[model samples]
Target chain A: MRETPSLIVRYVARRAVPFIQLYALYVLGHGEDGPGGGFQGGVIFASSFVLLALAYGWGQGRKHVPEKLFDLLAPAGCLLYAGIGFVALLVGGAFLQYEAFVGEGADHATKHHAHHFGLIGIELGVMLTVTASMVILFFEMSRPDEEGAFGDGASQEDVEALHDGSAATEEAPDA
Target chain B: MEVLILAILVGLAVAAVRARDLMASVAILGGYSLMMALLWCQMNALDVGFTEAAVGAGISTVLMLAALGRIGRREVGPTRAPLLRLPLLTMQQRLRRARHLSRQHHRSSAWGAILVCVLVGGALLYGTRDIPQVGASDSPANRAGSLAEYYVTKAPEEVGPANMVTSVLGDYRGYDTMGETVVIFTAALCVLMLLRQARVRRGDERDA
Candidate 1:
């Protein structure tokens, strides 16, 4: 939080985050053709948010993504991934079977299209899970704690207590 | 070209290891990862290269820098010569006064870490001798009976993937990728539990 006091860093990060977030979406959506994938795109997405925190501190970051929402987002991503696979099982096919999604696709081209569609479904799941996880990890590690216990946030009381503890330690040398 | 890249890799690795400042070391590690990403690109593994550049060089570097904030930047000096050295940096001294730290030093621990690094590096170098030749058509990895041939020939016709890696990752090994997503979710949950703050505010009887 102390490291994020620079005006230029906040300015640059604010300007750059939108573009980074946009690229993350592009990478996730157009992943089938390029060097992008769900995991790669997700991490990139998370880093954009992480930049917000690193540049402007947890106060601004928390405003952008509430801590409670982030806690739910991570597990929701994983569940989305598993839900797609479960659909196949419910449709009388082996788990994660793409051919099961083909309802009227009687030909090879149609079948191929179905597989492509299925791949996109899982990719979305991966993107969500990875993005949520990376964001959560960043938020967790970068949190400034009160009692040196790596807590969620630092309160005024914690700061005062910290000062008191330091003062006590300082005076002990003479006593 | 490979030799040049390898030389750069070696140099970066050494630089990363020898760097005294934790922040500087993290920056060097990021550079090293970028080099590895370039090497992967040269080898035509674009997806792997992209992931390496994004995750290892980008996010991991940021994460290291963030984590470094919790701990001391300076490695406590083990040499007795610097024991009495009280740096007279006025600005820094004021900053240090504001932030309290408890430092401990062990020269043997540093030596042990160096020894471990040497052993690991040596073992890796030794293991490289047994590796099959790169890009060899006759090598076990690329032989006629190998799985690579099947994936190359059959994937397009059967799986209909624009990218073979996707075909393999999402279809042939769909379970594996899904498992990876679950792992990511689990990690998120663990971090959440660890970092979540639970506090109970007490009614002040002292004020009354």
Candidate 2:
């Protein structure tokens, strides 16, 4: 409701986002060795953006992560994922076959090496897609339009209609 | 420990359901997700627990708050229900009004719904008895030569990932993960389209 949250919230959120993002990357990169992976990491990463948005207001948050960048990254991750699969196919193996990334050595070390890198690449792709998608979702959903509940263009009747005609009266004096 | 978490989860569920304020309901739902995440960790599914904590508790709560910002937080209901008016009435009048209000307000249907939910829940609880206990080696899933057995035995050797869960998810079950990613992408795009279209329409109306 307020243009920006209180100073404490803004400061805490600003300070926390970088650490949250770093943790998300740790979860993503450590997926193969630990208990987290792309989805969890990506959500954690997006939560940083969401936290910033809540603290700084949507306009300032949008500036941090622009629409054009979100659009580019959203599809890019999915493409990267699919591209890995296609590359496996091109290497003359089944779809999504990580073993194909390495040539036909059939040795244990080569297979293991290929699978390791392949999983990392795939998780990275997944992380990118998930992160971009979630950030955009928060941005789009929270972006105040002219007809929103507290938007400037909303008439008294429209606001009343949205809030069952009683709640707006309770908060009107504050606004 | 699991029992404690599950109890808290049930309490949170009831609190979320019975909350009069939508904002309170969202907060209660977040608590429920956090409890569920703890339960998942207790069950040794750390990835799922992490996801439940992040997506269920963190992201969804923020999204709901954003949505509440757009639409008012109050649930759409009668501002002045008969129950609230009872303070002015005498004892007998209050009793009569309470009975009348209950019948008028589909109280019987609510009771029926509660009854149905109890029956369905009991059935589900009964059905769980037939399920194999956790990590039961004789179970169909863990039986020798089954796909699970193969994955458990060979995942590290085959995929070179110490975490079998990631190896399975990223490689063996790669298609499913890809589909999930696409679904998320599509869902975001859908929301974007709907919200953008509404904004555009409003802008056009202002221009007109």
Q: Model 1 in CAPRI terms: which quality?
A: acceptable
- Candidate 1 residue lDDT tens string, B1-208: 8789899999889777665556668999999999999999999999999999999999989877667655644445532211112353367764664343323435577679899999999999999998888888988989997999998898887779778888888888999998888888887777666655322121233334
TM-scores for chain A over all candidates: 0.78, 0.83
Give the Å shift of residue A75 in candidate 2: 1.4
CAPRI-style docking class of model 2 based on DockQ = medium
Q: Model 1 scores what on Cα lDDT?
A: 0.77
TM-score of each: 0.78, 0.86
- Each model's fraction of native contacts: 0.65, 0.80
Q: Which is the leading candidate under TM-score?
A: 2
What lDDT does each candidate get? 0.77, 0.83
lDDT of 1 at A55: 75
